[model samples]
Target: MGRVAVTGGTGTLGRTAVCALRAAGHDVVVMSRRTAPGLATADLLTGAGVEAAFTGADVVLHLATSRGTADRWQTQTVVDAVRETGGTARVVYTSIVGVDKVPSSYYRTKLRCEDLLHASGLRCAVVRVTQFHEFLGDFFASQRFSPVLLTPDVPVQPVHVRDAAAALVRVVSDDAVGRLPDVAGPQVLDGRTAARAYRDARGWHRPVLPVRLPGRAFRAYGAGHLCSPDAAVVDGVTFSGWLREQLGSAALT
Candidate 1:
């Protein structure tokens, strides 16, 4: 049981990670930008309170992420805080699979962050995972208002966030190993099929239309750059199974 500081501890994956760490008897310190009881306020985006949050931590689980261009800054700030604290805490970072291959700005920042962590001269481990089931759900939900759900033609293997969180905790508990095996869901399907599955799960009868995404990013996805079939460590929960649980009997096959 080590004293661990988890940045973005209140977020989707971070919440599950913090729970798992605490359940395993680790002294957990939650670091976020918001001030709340039992949680430390550390703005990774601004470098405020980071030193105090990471003080005396054995491991720093860096999980903060952004969808915009500020992603790299957030990660660099974490690295700076770790160096500034003068502590020997191992940094465990959660990343997405295929960041190196994807052409998106967010993914590129993630790749840069990986490089930053490697050159920081600290004990570090990076665990890359596929998109989460919840992320897909949200994505589909956002486009539901249209007459038809316009889905991308790319393939996706959506891992359960809880499973990803568990893998992260395991890495944190072990010796720091750089760039661990990629974690993914047990099944892979094209966006149309995935969207159909989600639609059925929610009992939404809207038709799902497959639309081709343009540019190098879409090409990379179409080329299966987002998938790591051989290197993927499969999690037990399939997207269908998780949807069934969430929607109860309403979820279809």
Candidate 2:
């Protein structure tokens, strides 16, 4: 098994991927900007210590992402560092399913990073996935103090982070690379339904207000841009199952 280096190993997805890789019997090294234990100290933002982090890595999972347009710069830095080392590593990047369809700034930056990797002259795979269950949970969390939970009126398929990580593990071992198929959870539900399920799972009765804005991003979301029902390479766990696991089976009552 070759050494695998994961950037942003501290992030939710990154951490799950690292565990999956290790479980698959690959030697894994975690690359992070922080000086934490077991992390190969590296920063994609300033391009510091990346070379050392990627040293001897046969496959690099470039899962490190930041807010705004920082990915454009961080991605370029990754390309440079990998190319400088003869470009032997295969990069399995984690991208969102609706990056091309969504006009949001974050999605656009992810698309740009995908472009960079494609032209970087290294073996790479752009694996797009739908929103994670935790991401939706975070959205609900953001509205915790609100009197009413406002959810976008659109369909969502939220995959578990572990499922997403397992799909990535398959991609890492596959010889084929570049623009891989999308991956997502097993169930699709409207935002209202999802929010209600979340509320029920948490044993909380709250007013779920469904809202639709006129923005292109919202419209795109309403059109199911966040769903990958047709193109998923890996069909994963259902949202209800994930909720049950997190909140326990009794919470669903």
Candidate 3:
């Protein structure tokens, strides 16, 4: 069994990856700022608590979010820590598809992080994935009061979080580097369809108002920047299925 370190180990995907690794009989170490049981605390931004966590680790799964300028610095810090502690460690970075096509600040930061990882001179695997099913809930919360769900005129291929996690696990277990084919949902669904599905599943009375999103970011999304049409390996529960499960559980309460 190999020693694996998972950053953002408390997050949805990270937690799932940790569980999968443990289930496979691998020694798993969770790295995050919050002190959870069996977790190694580390602040990637300042690199204050990473070395000890990385010690003896054979593989590092990087899933932390570097927001703003801190994103670049934290990525560098993590890369450096991996180099200093375990030079031969396999670094697996989870990234978003079409990071270069989108002009959003977050995507830009993700691209920067990818660049840093590539230049770090470590054995690395960069896996890009489409939007997650959880994004629907986040969107609902962000626009709760709106009579209609306003979304960009973009095509989305949303995948389940578990599927994304599994892909990352595979990358960590295999010999791969650079950009792997993007991972996406089984089917491509537009924003309007997704929003309506979300609303109907939750019994929300809001109508889905599809708006043409402006800017380079929106253009990139509309141009299918977040999906991989030719990707061979696809996994995960479908979005509709996941939504139904969530709504069903909520209704039972």
After superposition, which runs of candidate 1 have C-alpha atoms over 4 Å from their true positions?
231-235, 250-253
Error of 3 at 223 (Å): 1.0
The order of the candidates by TM-score, greatest first, is 2, 1, 3
TM-score of 1: 0.94
Predicted candidate 2 versus true structure: per-residue lDDT over 14-90, tens digit per residue: 99999999999999999988897898998888888999888788988988888987888888888888887778989
Cα RMSD (Å) between model 1 and the true structure?
Answer: 1.6
Error at 37, model 3, angstroms: 2.2
* Candidate 2: clashing pairs of residues: none
Worst 10 residues of 1 by lDDT: 227-236
lDDT tens digits, residue span 41-128, model 1: 8888778899998889989999988877677788888788888888488999888889999898889988988988888888889988
RMSD (CA, Å), each prediction: 1.6, 1.7, 2.8
> Clashing pairs in model 1?
none
Candidate 2, position 77, lDDT: 83
- Compared with the true structure, the alpha-carbon lDDT of candidate 2 equals 0.85
Clashes of each: 0, 0, 0
Candidate 2's error at 100, in angstroms? 0.7
Angstrom error of the Cα, residue 39, model 3: value is 1.0
